[model samples]
Target: MLPRFLERLRQQADNLAGLLGNRVALFGIELQEESERLLGHLALLLGAAICTLFCLLSAVVAGLVLAARYGVLLEVCATLAVLFLLLALGLAWYLRRRLADAPEPFEATRQEFERDRLALNGARETAQ
Candidate 1:
């Protein structure tokens, strides 16, 4: 009877493990999806910034050439500064998005640790 009871307990634990495994798998997929989304957003934003920067730089160079010939060096310098500011802002925005979308590995580990600790405590209490 004691062996049968232990077998039943094992079966129950296996079932619980299966259920937990399914939940973890689902959550892992969700995390992967979120990570992919965050990466995609970053890639798109970076690509756009690169293209815009190249276009702006080319335009600035052309402007500088014209300005040098026309004695408008001050305006050229101001325009270049604004372009740099815009690029800096774009980079900051991308960084913010990446940070916001980052996953916390600690949460998952904490939950698993708590479950194991509880199991260990219950076993000790029952044995005592």
Candidate 2:
């Protein structure tokens, strides 16, 4: 009887360990997914920034060449430069606002943690 009881206890310990391992694996998977998503967004933003920079540079060069060919180069270039500067500032401000409005990442994980805490507190209260 003692040996059988010891075997059963060992079996239960192994099962508990397995359960914990599975939970850890699942948590790791969730973290990986979130990290991948963040990286993807970062990559896209970087690509967009590179493209916009190229476009802005092209536009400025084109504007300056046209102004030099058709009008007073210095005055036209100054005006174009100021216009582009203002446009860049406006876009930066808009991006700031948009970023502020963006949702928090890993919100689901936070909510799940809160729910678990509440449930544990409720269980503790019931026990008391």
Q: What TM-score would every model get versus the actual structure?
A: 0.65, 0.61
Best by lDDT: 1
Reference-based lDDT, each prediction:
0.79, 0.75
Model 1 residue 99 lDDT score: 76
How far residue 16's Cα lies from its native spot in candidate 2, in Å, is 9.4
Compared with the true structure, what per-residue lDDT tens digits does model 2 show for residues 31-98? 88868866876786687678878887898888878887988789877887787788778767866776
TM-score, cand. 1: 0.65
Error in Å for residue 29 of model 1: 0.8
